[model samples]
Target chain A: DAGITQSPRHKVTETGTPVTLRCHQTENHRYMYWYRQDPGHGLRLIHYSYGVKDTDKGEVSDGYSVSRSKTEDFLLTLESATSSQTSVYFCAIRATNTDTQYFGPGTRLTVL
Target chain B: QKEVEQDPGPLSVPEGAIVSLNCTYSNSAFQYFMWYRQYSRKGPELLMYTYSSGNKEDGRFTAQVDKSSKYISLFIRDSQPSDSATYLCAMTDNAGGTSYGKLTFGQGTILTVHP
Candidate 1:
């Protein structure tokens, strides 16, 4: 909601292929996060970055990796797409601690 | 047990009715609480945020947090059809600022307000 944009709003890929989703923010927020949403399940964190080049894995980070090379950009990569990874991906950013997170529209990824 | 528990109700209400959504967490250390609303096929949008115990009201929405009981609630004073969506509760410890992204979320509850 806060000047965040996610690229490739929808994607269909084959298993074993790699896919990258990009999150770009115009607000220069210091914190960025990647999460996946599935039916009946809450948004599960994949990875997050606190500052440029500082990243940490989340509860569901097995096959995913994240990079934050700049203040305005965060990238999430699925090293190898799988059917189980098919879901809606979201990017969120926060400018201060304990503050509300602003989210990008989202990217729907489907791997067959 | 899951750290956060929500009913995930497909709760239906008539227009202008008051609606309540709730979540209970197991982590006693969690001090920050929040509620988010997500429309169908859309990303979750924050509706309410509160820290510690007590309540905070904004416009027609009120958020309540009870750290002693490890529970949180969101009340909509006059629910309308526009309010229909999936409501999610998120919590963290010292979950403020531009760092420390460890907030945990509960399965959202689906609410429908009929006219």
Candidate 2:
């Protein structure tokens, strides 16, 4: 509830297609993260940005990429979608003053 | 072993009952502990957070961290139907570098409070 929102609440795309999910925040927090939630795996971080133009790979960053040009927006892109990549993606923002991270509504993506 | 472990339970309870959820971790470096509540098809919301080892209370929720045992718990007193959701336990080392905002999470436990 930290003024975060993820676009394309639901999506279905064929395998090998390019897909992009957008996460926008209004809190102006300095840190933003992208995570994918899959059954049995809990939530795995994909990528995160600590500041504008600053990014880092997470535990499960093999098939994904992320970019942040502005403090309020972070984007996750799948260059070539795969069936195994289908999952619910969530965006989170951490305020500079607090260690707690707030999440955005998730995006459910399916790769056929 | 996984960094953090939790039972993924669809625990059903009656309203006004006391609920307990737990998580155990293998890492001793974790200094920050948190609990997040996630509803179906929605984002997770932060419910409780604690640093080091101690008990922190907020309204109907209480979070306990035991660094020596590498275990943590969240207790809900007088639970309500609105409290039904998946509870996730997350931790971080608070290393203050590249790992500053990174958190490792446990497989969430599902709770349902029936009216």
Candidate 3:
């Protein structure tokens, strides 16, 4: 397992509140991604960063945002949380491609 | 249609049984197909990947991809209790994997290998 850790392994927040999940990697990989896992849907990419300050929207980016200020840290923030946004989020990092992707444990966020 | 489709099967099998998991995609541009195993409440771990079309075997796991049919499969021989996890099918195209491997994932099939 790659040394990847997600902070606030679990969190509960009120609707319309702001929440941020953090992913820190020791591998210093070039690519980092944020994805939300729902019951009926697989992991849906919210945003990803190819390098510091270089990011792009994913299919499910409408309600989410991301930032990668430093190579080791990637953050996913819900500007204003909604009940529909309750889901488990995962972070993945790869050296270059998809040959091997190490995942952080996960962050379970619930918007009440 | 979604790029990838997999039956979210709660497929149950007895210990030592052979288990088959699969996913199908519509994109012919997909060149890399991968299978990930995810335990509950955890992130997905890569299991197998087959570039283009063919079969690759490792340990008790076999991965098969038929690009002509846009179908990919993972077969586990002699399933074990530790193998009880959600199997997700993911694919990356030259279109998606360029900058970083942007993969499209299936809903994931839950499997339980019992004793």
Best by lDDT: 2
Candidate 1 docking quality: incorrect, acceptable, medium or high? medium
lDDT of 1 by residue, B1-115 (tens): 8899999999999999999899999999888788999998777888888889999999999999988888899999889999999999998876564447577899989999999
Report the error of model 1 at residue A58, Å.
0.5
Query: What is candidate 2's lDDT per residue for A82-111, written digit by digit as tens?
Result: 999999999999867556788999999999
Error of 1 at A3 (Å): 0.9
Highest DockQ, which number?
1
Clash pairs for candidate 3: none
lDDT tens readout by residue for model 1, A4-108: 999989999999999999999998788899999987778899999988999999999999998988999999999999999999999998746455677889999
Candidate 1: where is the Cα deviation over 4 Å?
B95-99
For model 3, residues B1-115, the per-residue Cα lDDT tens digits are 8889999989999999999898989988888788999987778988887788999999999999999998999999999999999999888775335566778899999999999
Better of 1 and 3 by lDDT: 1
Query: Distance (Å) between predicted and true CA of A68, model 3?
Result: 1.2
- Name the weakest run of 10 consecutive residues (lDDT summed) in model 3 chain A: A94-103
Write candidate 2's Cα lDDT for B1-115 as tens digits: 7999999998999999999999999988899899999998889898888989999999999999999999999999999999999999999888444444788999999999999
* Model 2 steric clash pairs: none
> Where in model 2 is the C-alpha error above 4 Å?
B95-99
Query: Per-residue lDDT for A1-112 in model 3, tens only?
Result: 5889998899999999999999999988888989899988888888988899999998899889899999999999999999999999899987564545668999999999
Q: How well does chain B match by TM-score in each candidate?
A: 0.95, 0.95, 0.94
| Candidate number with the higher lDDT (1 or 2) | 2
TM-score of each: 0.96, 0.96, 0.96
